[model samples]
Target: MKEKMLSFHDVKHIYHTVRGEVTATENLTFTVEKGEFVALIGPSGCGKSTLLSLAAGLLTPSEGEVSRRGSIGYMLQRDELFPWRTIEKNIRLPLEVQHRLDSESLERARTLAEKYGLGEFLQSYPSQLSGGMRQRAALIRTLAFDPDVLLLDEPFSALDYQTRLLVTQDVAKIIRSEGKTALLVTHDISEAISLASRVVVLTKRPARVAAEHELCFDGENDPLRRRENKQFSEWFELLWKELNA
Candidate 1:
């Protein structure tokens, strides 16, 4: 059996406002194993982001628990790169925050940037780089802290369709190369199919696991290439049914 890296047991969440109470999630339970690539897909307002917020400890569950084994890195819909900071500087921000900013760690971040094709632009400001490059820098920043699990909340949603495809491929290759576990929440079914080892479907509002699909592709694991695989259409059809069911 796979050793679980994180577990959500009977998790439930509710929001209380002057307007009324909103039940965002109920009986939400799942397990993420070490090095697993899982994607969460659901209709809009299905509590996907709420689930990530809980995992990041940004929000407390109204019931049950969200438990994790190690550090977690969260990348939101926007790259959220600091405009004034250079690519390298932004990448080193996490290390600085943790007070672990030493020569070795900085060098590690530079090595990752270089290994992932961002070396030459290390000193470049965020405005100097293209959208895709900025997103790459953001990912390198997230990984610099060496988090055990990565929570990606539609990291490519802000980009143009073309840029989204390339960045998605770039990010997936980087994560797989680094052997890190990832949990991605996306509304794009095709995006989920291309990136996930296991795709989890959630129901509308008060989100709950509706179904889980494990995908297999014969080609290289590149996100774009995976979309061209024969299994791609099959998986897409299956998920389409599940989502609209």
Candidate 2:
């Protein structure tokens, strides 16, 4: 059996604001197996971001359980890299914060940046690079910590359409090559279909699993190639109906 990297079991979360208590999710259940890419999709205000936080342990479920097998790396909608820090420095930030910074760890971070085409820009600040480059640096930074699973919450949503496409391709390759389990929360049906091995669709507010599908592409995992597949449109149409339904 495949090892389960992360799981949400009958989860319920309530947000207590000055206004009142809000139920974000109810009885949510799902499991991401090792090295699997799972995408969570739902309508607007369906508490998708809340789910990401729950996985990252930023929020505790009011009911049920959120479980993980190992450490997690979270990539936010924005790169969130400090402007004062260079790409290399940003990538090393996590390691430094975790007190895991050392010769070997530092070399690994540099190697990842180089492997991902950021070697030449290691000293460049976030402002010196385009939105796409900064996002890549953010991803490399997340990987530098060597987390067992990745939680990506719309990491490419900040870029232009063209940049979003390119960065999505690169991020998909990086995650697959590194053989890491990942949970991505996205509102885009096409993005979910292209990037994930399995897609979990949720209902509107007070979220619950609406549908779950295991994507099939005949061994093709590249986001760009998956977009080109004949099944791409079919999968899109199916997911689209699911979202609207």
**lDDT values for all models:** 0.91, 0.95
| Candidate 1 lDDT tens digits, 1-245 | 98787778899899899999999999888888998899999988898999999988899999998899899999989999999898889999999999998889988998999998899998899999999999999999999989999999999999999999999999999999999999999999999999998898998878888998777685367888888888889989988898888
Q: Write down the TM-score of every candidate.
A: 0.97, 0.98
| Model 1 C-alpha lDDT versus the unseen true structure | 0.91
Candidate 1, superposed: residue stretches over 4 Å from native: 218-220
Which pairs in model 1 have colliding backbones? none
Report the C-alpha displacement of residue 62, candidate 2, in angstroms.
0.3
TM-score of decoy 1: 0.97
- Provide C-alpha RMSD values for all models, in order: 1.1, 0.7
Clashing pairs in 2: none
